[model samples]
Target: MARAETRTHPDTADAALLEGGRVGLSGRWTADQGAAVEDAAARIAGSAAGAPILVDLSQVSRLDTLGAWVLERTRAEIEAAGGRLAYAGAAPEHRILLSEVKLRAAEPAPAPRGRLYGFLEDLGKRVVGAKSDLVTGLAFFGEVVTACIRVAARPGTFRGTALVNQIEQVAFRGVPIIVLISFLVGGIVAQQGIFQLQRFGAQSFVVNLIGLLILRELGVLLTSIMVAGRSGSAFTAEIGSMRMREEVDALRVMGLDPIEILIVPRILALVIGLPILTFLASLAALAGGGLTASLYGGMTVDAFLARLQAAVSLHHVAVGLIKAPFMALIIGIIATIEGFAVEGSAESLGRHVTASVVKSIFMVIVLDGLFAVFFAAIDF
Candidate 1:
């Protein structure tokens, strides 16, 4: 104990300091005393660098987290400046709290990751995500094939009620819109052909373009696209909602395969329904083309009918109709896969539903292109 000199703080919080690097804290050092405590700690740290300092808290009748933090901060600053500090005469509880605070305060924050590294990491994750989606799609496709085979072997296992219901929903209900859209498309094609051919005085050829295009490509393609957006999206939302409500899980628990019960009926319906819808859509489009040619292109109905009847071969009709079931298969696969992928959240349901429609539309277009190339190479 060297000769001690007393330094008293103007605030009641600090009380005084003694000689030989000793400081005394007093009174309630709560959040109310925050500013005064930090000020006193800073002064001591500035003057006592590399010196042995002792803190006397015997007079501190009360302490809280705020005051404990202040003292810990002072100790940290002193140690950083090459000084040694100690707490003496502290309560057991306070010592524990101060030690914990100091431990927490000393931990370093995580450094920021580099931008290039972040970009590479994100790209890798996306690639992995894309691969996962592809694998899931293929697995679902396989499940559909297996289920269809089983149904084929045991015809009694087929759910006719479910199949008919799905057909009514996905095909019958969709017929009006399909007819309207296909008619408009046919009329637009006829109008455009007439407009372009009028310059060459070959306006009679408008009937040929309308008939050939409607039968060979636009008929099936447009109908499939519409079905994918309308019915395909509905299928996803329906199954996804069932999945979210745990109905699909209940089917599994009851010893029934969800794929066979839920998916097969829809696939069967689409396969059976799309070709019929495609044919009706083709007829509607041809009717529109004939109307447009008669009214706009000034071609008589007989002439248009004769030209259309001559221009459209049965092979053209077969090509369009043949692609229908395949496109339906693609749409069904995409929609069902996305539906089963839904998580237990409304957000997940919405996202998967959107993904279903988008993926179905994209696949439908891709399949159309593939069909075009195949047909062209075979000179169909």
Candidate 2:
């Protein structure tokens, strides 16, 4: 057997060539030689590019797993550059070790994609995601409806305690902010209507404008938005955290439907709580309008009350309140769906909570528009 003779190339001490298209490797090539081995491997890989080459490692007196990894990486680089690599007379013991390292180090690289391809792939992914979201929302809506009917059938199964607790959470606790927001909104509406109507010598009609707009449109719309932001996000976060903790799975294992346990109470609470909240908001708004009328429009409280009574009928108030349950349904369903979709991570919880709020707000506005169109068509 011919011993592998190793000598440095004239120009590069780190690399050397030998007979029979063989590249000679020398030195300890151990863990401490990591950096040098890597550098040498790159040079060896470049030299072998576009051609088949043999590597003689019999001259490497001392070696380690790190050095084997470096060589394996060089072998991959050469193959990637359209070259074939062959080991020349590796020692019997090192052969098994090097083979094991090579097997472990042979990781596939991510395929390079073109800009257009990447864009199209991303677009496809988004379209699929939207479809999935729609399906999930519809399925969740159906499940909630079913749960409601089931619980309604068995009054004893009704979770009144949980429902009341949710009412306090999404409604009672939210009253202060709701009142403050409605008050400011009403004042703004009154001021704007007064300014505009005064120019038209219709200052008194500002009372009618505020009454119609707040009761028929703005009151419920603003209230729903606030509730979606405050309560809807909370629902998603709470449920999502439960999902991450595997409590939802535990409930299922215990033969309890998660929707019945985690969702129905919240939905019922919203349906009941939202109307109460909306009615209160409407009153707060009316009070704000009255204050604005007294101060900005130089109208008496009695005059404001008389005008409001004449302008806003029970029908207008009913229209706003009637929309509340539907809006609540939308918000609750979106929140619950987003929550249940949570993966096992805090980041997923945060993302789903945000999505719940956004989707709830968007759906509320859309539902409001549909109601407006329907009312107009029905002469309501």
Candidate 3:
């Protein structure tokens, strides 16, 4: 027979090799033993080394959860290394503790994906999501139009106060920042134009560039983007909060059409307010361009005004204004759609609000690009 190997830990714990590959454990086996119990368990696992072994626990004076967990983990490690572990002579309480601490094996890690495969997977998901969003947006738009028709048929259902309130929120209060930003942008464009054109002795043409660009594209585009970020986000957050609190369901119970009461006024306000804002923003940009021309391009204010008057046509102004209501409708629809998607959590509300702003801005830009192509094609 092989000489018995023994590892002892005074009164705390001990592991002793016995006859027939049996490991005898003794003394207190509890949290109080701490490192001694851990050390003994580790020794048993290492010595087993893919061999069959039986752990005898009858000699144990006390056993607790920590001791049981350590023993179970050691057994798991031994079994994973192709060894067999069995407990024998365990007291009833010790057997129960061991059963409770028999932890399940951890799941295996996933295989690493190739970069191209990962990219394709992500792209496919985004394309599918975009398709779904487009279909949902169209359905919501139809609902909004239906609501508008209902309100038009019964003028008494129109919420004039709500419309006025939204106009104040979306247009009047937004004027200061919109004007300031448009002014700065126009001034920068004028300064750059003067710098580029002076090299060719055609600095006076910068006035035509500023007038056409601001009236035809930049003015309404900038205003719409700002409104999407400001008012659109507000719409989503307001409605998302109401959704979280179940007020939307309450409206249905009360026989009130949520779309007519909640969304129509907001969309109508955007339709009315955006064009007025576009006009104001264009004027502000023109003023800024004139100031920059006088200061940097060696042109007097009166001369700049004369050049602007001669360069810009009503057709250019009409192009910018015509895009406003469409962009407004897009923003309002996207905002309300995301609002109604919110779940009963703050995280969902915030996520949908952000998505509303991002989607609105992206769609606004796409719509503008499409309009640009159509206008170019038709010679508008």
Candidate 4:
């Protein structure tokens, strides 16, 4: 094996090769030599002005994949510049190896990954527009309520069965999952509270912590998540499908108020249902927390119940229940607006359904944050 050496030839093959570092593989030219060879080649290519360079690999001790790749790249750069690079002084044993190993240099990837900033800016604009639609839909809900009052008084104006079915689907089928989530949340709160209060020898206060937080925050948050997944998406899909089928047009043609006959009842049902569900959720959460505390936290069920009584205020329960109707109204209006905005197509339906769920959940979270700030400020 021969160590590689550099020698600049005075009489070279081309005018391009006459400048500096024209054509020699530097250092030990072998598989392990790595970038030393490539660096030498790059230096040679960069030294001349629009000149061809021939690389002398004759003294190479060994040729490996890396050495071959570097040579191939150098050759490419030379050819790209309308210049030439030639191989010279190869060992007989290197013939078969060099022939077997070829380097395919990767093409440079294109720039601009579809203007990400512009795409996000456009998305932000659409989100602002969608929230505006939510506010407008909320205002429109007043007219819907008025229409509902008239329809309820008349009782003969709408399809009661269909409306009742929708309400049941929203409220009834959702109870088990709601109960499970609220119960787990209550258990988690109990664990945290026990850990904190145990420092003061007040482990039994876990019940109070669970009761207060669950009734106030967790109950509303969980219910909102549920409605976002369940009723909100359903609202979008229902109204979107109605739009797709032109049933909304049929209702308009019949001189019936779509707001009254179609939208209002659903919104009213959610408003009515959410608070009822929250109250049930509070009970279930308390039970779950009490059970966990009694079993693991060295608290008796009677003691847990007693402390729960002392810690949770009727005011807190009322506050949470109050928030539910507002949350429900927000979800209802947002979902309904997205549904109505859906164009008459299946793809649009899917898109709007996803949008409705997302918007409803976001609005619920924002509203919850506002509630937290306001209530915390007022000590509610």
Best by lDDT: 3
- Please give the range of 10 consecutive residues that has the lowest summed lDDT in model 3: 1-10
Off by over 4 Å in 4: 1-131, 152-163, 196-200
For candidate 2, which ten residues in a row score worst on lDDT?
4-13
Instruction: Rank candidates, TM-score, best first.
Output: 2, 3, 1, 4
Q: Which candidate tops TM-score?
A: 2
TM-score of each: 0.74, 0.81, 0.75, 0.64
Poorly placed runs, candidate 2 (over 4 Å): 1-31, 42-51, 54-73, 76-82, 87-128
> What is the clash count for each candidate, in the order shown?
0, 0, 0, 3
| Residues 39-113 of candidate 4: C-alpha lDDT, one tens digit per residue | 566665675346655566665656666666666676677677877766666677665666666555677986666
Of the two candidates 1 and 2, the one with more favorable TM-score, higher being better, is 2
Total colliding residue pairs, candidate 2: 0
Greater-TM-score candidate between 1 and 4: 1
lDDT of each: 0.86, 0.87, 0.93, 0.76
lDDT of 1 at 251: 91
| lDDT for position 154 in model 2 | 88
Q: lDDT per residue, candidate 1, 168-256, as tens digits?
A: 99889989999999998898998898899999999999877977787888999999999999989899999999989999999999998
| Residue range 33-143, candidate 2, lDDT tens digits | 666677778778767748888888777777788888788887877787788888876888778878888844445998999999999999999889889988988888898
Question: What is candidate 2's local distance difference test score?
Answer: 0.87
